[model samples]
Target: MAENHEHGKMDITEQEKTFEGFVKASIWVAGVAIGILVFLAIFNS
Candidate 1:
């Protein structure tokens, strides 16, 4: 098999954007989950 190995020649803008979006979404989800847990703990006592 012929191998074409080029370093830093590939377009990664889309991948970077997708990863940024994933990180943002993960942080938001975690914050919301923690907020819900705090609310439940405070009100359920």
Candidate 2:
């Protein structure tokens, strides 16, 4: 049996963070848009 121990460093850049935030915001915005459309359709019918 052999065992190995190793670790790697990870870092996130500002651009990556901003992009992640943008992705999250867009997802929420899309979800809200869908909900609104559904509400309008049901409300009018």
Candidate 3:
């Protein structure tokens, strides 16, 4: 039997690993989506 070893390398940064960063990102995405929707609604009519 062979023992498995971990690579121990992280693909993501430490700043993006925090809950605060996640919430901030979610809010930013939501705001952008809402702005797009509003623009489409106003221009489509």
Each candidate structure's TM-score, on Cα atoms with residue i matched to residue i, is 0.88, 0.70, 0.61
Which stretches of model 1 miss by more than 4 angstroms?
Answer: none
For candidate 1, report its TM-score: 0.88
Q: List the residue pairs that clash in candidate 3.
A: none
Residue 23 of model 2 has an lDDT of 100
C-alpha lDDT score of every prediction, in listed order: 0.95, 0.85, 0.82
Model 3 segments more than 4 A misplaced: 1-17
C-alpha lDDT of candidate 2 relative to the true structure:
0.85
lDDT of 1 at 41: 98
- Among these predictions, the greatest TM-score belongs to 1
How do the residues 1-45 of candidate 2 rate in per-residue lDDT, one tens digit apiece?
224533433355877999999999999999999999999999998
* Reference-based lDDT, residue 23, model 3: 96
Ten contiguous residues minimizing lDDT sum, candidate 1: 1-10
Write model 3 residue lDDT over 18-40, tens digit each, in one string. 87789989999999999999999
Evaluate residue 36 in candidate 3 and report its C-alpha lDDT on the 0 to 100 scale: 99
- Candidate topping lDDT: 1
Clashes of each: 0, 0, 0
Query: What are the per-residue Cα lDDT tens digits for candidate 1 across 2-44?
Result: 3785878889999999999999999999999999999999999
> In model 1, what lDDT does residue 5 have?
59
Residue 2, candidate 3: Cα error in Å is 27
